[model samples]
Target chain A: MNMREYRLGVSHGLPVGMGYFSVSFGFGAMAVSQGLKVWEATLISLTNLTSAGQFAGLTVIVAGATILEMILTQLIINSRYALMSLALSQRMGQRIGVFPRILIAFFNTDEIFALAMARHEPLTVPYLLGLGTLPILGWTGGTLCGALAGSVLPVSIRNALGVMLYGMFIAIVVPPAKREREILAAVGLALVCSSLFAWLPVLQKVSAGISIVLCTLVSACICAAVFPVKEEAAV
Target chain B: MNILLYILAMALTTYLIRVLPLTIFRKPIRSRYLRSVLYYVPYTCLTAMTFPAILSSTTSLVSGAAALAVAVFLAYRGKSLIVVALSSSAAVLAAEAVMRLAGLL
Candidate 1:
């Protein structure tokens, strides 16, 4: 746990923290629009540490979905992180015992995962901690700032900011979709299915949590079957 | 009360998903099919979360759709995430301002 290495890791984390600040700002504003108070929204960000899971959970909550629905939605949406954690665990080496591993797991956002995996050597606890610190603060701080702004902003402006969440979603999906045929097909299918869930009478009655789970599973299954990625690229 | 419970359940669920694998899986899972499925999860989830809802999220469907178009285009052109978000939000705000002035909002 060298201090110099820890400092370097934290410095590398600064950009991810900056990016998270803007994205979570949108999340906070959207959460407020959905009726959560500033503190509640920030609390969710602090606890969840996930973008899609938090967003989906907020949707479920706003829709007045039940507790079972909330749990299931988060499980399905965030299960990908389990895979990431598995990949990371294999890389961080065995000196990392149970407690530090658990701590690192909590901090393993997508950006952190990428940065840690890119390292040529096995990761250390302090370095991982250093990487986690700023992003955590940035995420929660962004939520707090945005939620406060949401509460104070005029109605029209708050409504305008609501689109930012969707904008962030686009920023996440578009680059990959544009580059990969399989992803494009899967996303297109998901969009069509989601629209039906929203507009079709019988499907419209389906809970938001159920609809998201259904759409994600169905689309992912279809892509996994039809476009089974080649072995090397699957990783 | 219910929101608090929901957030707690969500945090618990998310934490377990992340920690279980880190604790349990010392070796990478070898199944290609399963890995591919995991790879597709974010794409499907984000896409499902984005659409139809985005259409209704803004002050008007027209403004929302216009902003979405701008977002997709900018992203396809390789814009960074923050840039794409800022530009798309700017597009929506600008479009809404026009719509409001025209008494169309």
Candidate 2:
């Protein structure tokens, strides 16, 4: 593995690390609010790298959910990683072995997946590992600090920071959405779908995890059919 | 112990989802429709997660809207994600403090 490739990966991961830090801070606060100790909150972030899955699973834990319930919730919430991994698998070099694949898969969060997939060159094992390292540290470290300081943070400040994650999401989508009419329409469709599921009585009964999956799948399929983007147009 | 088990289960389940596809699928997916769906997954999922929930994440609706507006503008202007996130959060903090002082929250 060339040092240059690994360094390149780290450089690319810097922004992702920063984003993960803030988002996991919010998760840490949420976990603390749900009655977990700081160490427990950090442990959750360490083991589960997903924001939505960790939040949803923690809610189930707070509710005294059954193990089966927890499993189902996590499976549904985290199923998107399967798609990301599948897409990334095609990008990896054919010679990559099992151990690196296993290690790379463990740290494959949404941001990492998006960043890796955007690359035009084939993804290498060392580069993938390098890319995964800082974001994992940032995620775990942020959770640790936030969990430890959860009580010290005032409620208003915590509430204010609440918008940071959503802001990051907007930052991610808006630039691309502005450049691509198809992406903009898909985003709008997904937004409308989620709002419907949230407000409609029967649909509202569905779990948040399931609602997200349903909305994403339905909107994605409809968007693909109505506005299939050309290869060059996709980024 | 039960809590530990829950964490372990979650980790295991999440890891399996990530690994299964990465290990098993060596070739690129061939289906056009499937490719399109996969292509749009990130945008759709991120959008779905962002909206509706974002409306209620802040201390007040006005604060949330204000933060979102700032975020979109900064993002459009090509500010980095970290800058956009922090600046919008700062905006919300300011809006929240003002609202609280004015008894609007």
Candidate 3:
């Protein structure tokens, strides 16, 4: 175990964990308001570690949907993770063994995946674990606090805090987009596609998860065809 | 409705979606097109999730747009994640405060 790599992973994870704390705080408050016990909300955060999927799952549970419905909802909402996982798997290569892969999979939330991918160096199991540790703690810990507190924070502060994760997303995308025309094109295409999904009457009916997946696929495919990364740079 | 069952099922479904690709696809992808798509996926996915969505994330469109503008500017200038994120949140608060002062919120 390289302590240096582990520490670097932990440092990279800190901001992500903080962002997760704020988002999951909202999730916890919403879960309690919807009648979940504090422990139950915290447990969901700990076990599932997904924002959209858990929120959608909660809706299914509250609606008294069948388990099959629950499964289907999760499958659609979290399907983007499949793509992210595939990309991350390639990024990690075979150095990450089965056991570590399984463990890392549990903490492969969107932010963690982005942070991991941003690293220029080859990934290691210890680093991945360190990257994951605080996020799990923050997510579950925030849920526990939020569920217990039950929306104690004022509306204005909550509203402001809500943008934290999106801000981080922008931070991650902008640097790379600025450096590469293909990436910029892909980001721009995704922006337009997602806007259509959000606003078009017919397309707005599509769920957020599916819409994101569709946007990603469309934008990525177009960019790939137009501007294939140089052979050596693809790695 | 069994809550434990619901949570377990939800967790399992999400876990499987995340875990399968990682464990199954250990080899490097040789296809250039596919690799390029993978290379571009993170940016596209993050951008898709950020926009339009961020515009509606805050208390009002004004505050949300303010946050987006602040985030983009800071990020374009090569700010760190924490700085960009906190600055964006601060922009939201500032925008909301202005709106409130103007009796618009």
Candidate 4:
């Protein structure tokens, strides 16, 4: 990587790391509260980095569900990442190295993807490798601290703190929404689908992960058909 | 032996699911349809997790009801999600207080 890209990567890593801290901490605390050992909780946040999949998997574990259910749940919840990775490959530089791509792909997420894509230059493998590392480190570190201090923290505090991950998510969503007005429709569509899934009895039995997959799929299909960009203003 | 293998397999499969796709699909994929799907994925995923927890927390529905209203207001008004989240949580906690005083869960 060039010196400039390396510097930029490190600088970008800070906000991403700080942003990730609370979300990972919450994950760790939740895992520990759910009866996992600290190391297991730490490992989960480090490895998965996906709140929805891990949470769904944890639920399956608690219920003693079969492996088929476990596999299906994780697959459904994480399927969206494939789409994100696809969007990213377009931005990859010529002759992007395989190892970093392989390693960083494991940690691919909304925030890191946004940061990588925001660059003026091509998103090279080294730059992404450097960028993806610290954010995940902060997350796993947060998980460890939260798990270690799981019980000492008061319930009310935990209740309030649990919402920060949602905040981080909104931060990621709002920027793109501003760039493209079609996003408003997308949000509305997704929300309506979610509400239907939650309220309608026929759909309520669908596992939460499956519900997400179905809702996202249906919402995206509807929004794409109804709210195509005006040809000149792509997001 | 079986349980240990299950855990090991879970870890391996999870890693493979995450990394394997990128290895194959190295070309630039220009599917606006799929990007739209990814954009909405977060909301659906968040709702899937939060909807059940927030709903189950209240019995009488007054507090959770109020909290939902507050959350929607804050989010719509361009207030930060943190602010919206705080106000809604406060609403629920306060609602719980009232319900406790009134002998409800």
Candidate 5:
């Protein structure tokens, strides 16, 4: 294992883990309030590792929805991960074997995926594993704490903590966008598309997951056609 | 209802969606256009998720917008991820405090 890359991954993952803690804290509190056991909530976090999909799944479970409904909901909400994984497949270095790929896929979340993609070098197994560890712990651990404590945190603190992940997202995207005109244009196009989905009466009916997928597809396609990355730079 | 069964099903479904692509597409993609799309996907996806959603993420629109402004400024100036993230959260806390003091929240 490359110790340097592992440490680098761990350091980069710290903020992601911290952000996951607050979000999963809210998730745990919500699950318990809806009558789930603390362990059960933690188990969901341990196994799922997805924010939106888990939340939606919890709603389905609480509503006594059919397993088919649960499957469909998770399939749709978490489908974007498939896209992320596809992109990530090309980024993986030769060191990432099938076993590591299987393991890494479990935690191929939005934040981690973004961080890995932003790396100029191909992804290594050690780095990916190091990155996944804290997030899994934070997610499960925070859920346990939240389920047990159930909103012991003050409202003001919780409110401030809510935007932590989005802040990280902006931080990841903005620097790259600033450096590349094509990326900047893609970001702008995505913003406009997402805004329309959020606000337009007709588009408002689209689910958040589908809206994100569509916005990303539209923006990425336009940028790719208009300004395909030079072959040398793509590698 | 078997809750564990539901959890298992949800977990399995989500995992399959993620794992299939990674395991199947081990070889590098050769298409330049496809590679370009992949390159742009992360930025576009993250951007779509952040905006509009970030505005509603906090207690009030004012605090949320404050966080966005702070985050964008710091990020544009090439701040590190941790710095930008913490500053944005701090911005939210500070904005909410000011709003509370002014009876706007």
Candidate 6:
């Protein structure tokens, strides 16, 4: 039974696992280039598949941002995972034991969520197990390989891989935004607001950490206010 | 102070972000506001992380970002993921060469 379930999990997670491998390859190489050891970079992928968090955290590490800064930055950047987990719990068909859930939570990333949601059936613990495990393993493994090849690949090649991260973000946002006018509006609103801060001198000084929180909250709030999702009375 | 301790500390702190919320919100999160918040948070975080470093990597800000933008456009227009990744990355490489030759960046 366990064997079959494990196989099932791997089947469901192949796309995510492979995608993470590519993405984290760049991340691993970058981390090493930025002076983290290969082991440290690989460990980052193992512990946190939260790409944005790691990228942001790398900045803090490079800049030697204070402990308080790291805490606050990570909290704001990663707050959405709390939401992802909430949605995931509702979808998880099997009840999760605390220890297992803790382990799974560590690797709950966008690729995994997209892969899991693409499935027809509601989630099972084994399925969630697949979603979490394979991708992270792929990520860690890719990072190791990338870190090893860091020097031979050259900086231009490395810099080019950085665009993969950007491509991923645009790929994530543009599709849904195209379909839903509201989502598109929220994105446009954020782009405008953020860009304004970009062009404006005073606002540019506002921390990126704070800017993300404010922009997301304000943009999302405005959208919600304009086009509220009606919750029918639960009879 | 040591590297192992540093890795462990950062790792623990990073884990705590995802951990604390699941612990508190053990049950289903049905809050509409919160769900809406979740939908947009990752993008904001991505932008925050990526924007600062992207421009300085090359001389011309527009070309590198534009190449990626074109790839994204093609992707949204229904190109395959591989197409998007390769073409966009190709765009960046191509653009840098052009910008350097043109001396516009």
| Native contacts kept, each candidate | 0.82, 0.75, 0.83, 0.22, 0.81, 0.32
DockQ for all models: 0.79, 0.61, 0.58, 0.31, 0.55, 0.42
- Which lDDT values do the candidates have, in the order given? 0.87, 0.80, 0.82, 0.63, 0.82, 0.66
Scored against the true structure, residue A203 in model 4 reaches a CA lDDT of 82
What would you estimate as the lDDT of candidate 5? 0.82
Tens digits of per-residue lDDT for model 5, B17-101: 8999899866655788877887787678778778898888677999989999999999999997667767887898999999999
User: How does the DockQ of candidate 5 come out?
Assistant: 0.55
Candidate 3 residues lying further than 4 Å off, grouped into runs, are: A1-41, A50-97, A108-128, A146-150, A232-235, B1-10
Please name the candidate that would achieve the greatest DockQ relative to the true structure: 1
Q: Which docking band does candidate 3 fall into?
A: medium
Docking class of 6: acceptable
Model 5 misplacement above 4 A: A1-41, A50-101, A107-131, A146-150, A232-235, B1-10
lDDT of 4 by residue, B1-105 (tens): 233333344555566665665677766436665555555555555554554345443444576565666665566567753465457657666776777788865
Q: lDDT tens digits, residues B1-105, model 2?
A: 478988888888888988988888666556667677767877887787777877777768888888888998999998887888788888888888888799987
Candidate 6 lDDT over A65-117, as tens digits, reads 45666666667777777766655555553566667667667766766766665
lDDT of 3 at A197: 98
Pairs clashing within candidate 5? none
TM per prediction: 0.96, 0.85, 0.76, 0.76, 0.72, 0.84
| Model with the higher TM-score, candidate 3 or 6 | 6
- Tens digit of lDDT per residue, candidate 2, span A111-139? 89888988888888878888988899999
lDDT of 2 at A18: 78
- Quote the B-chain TM-score, candidate 2: 0.83
- Model 3 has fnat of 0.83
Candidate ordering by DockQ (highest first) = 1, 2, 3, 5, 6, 4
Give a tens-digit lDDT track for model 1, residues A1-235.
6898789889989988998898788889889978898889999999988888999999888988788989899888987898889888878778889999888889988779989989886688889999998999999999999898988887667766777767778988998898889999999999999999999998998988899999999999889988888875654
Give interface RMSD for all predictions: 1.3, 2.9, 3.8, 4.3, 4.1, 3.8
- Report the number of clashing residue pairs per model: 0, 0, 0, 0, 0, 0
Better of 3 and 6 by lDDT: 3
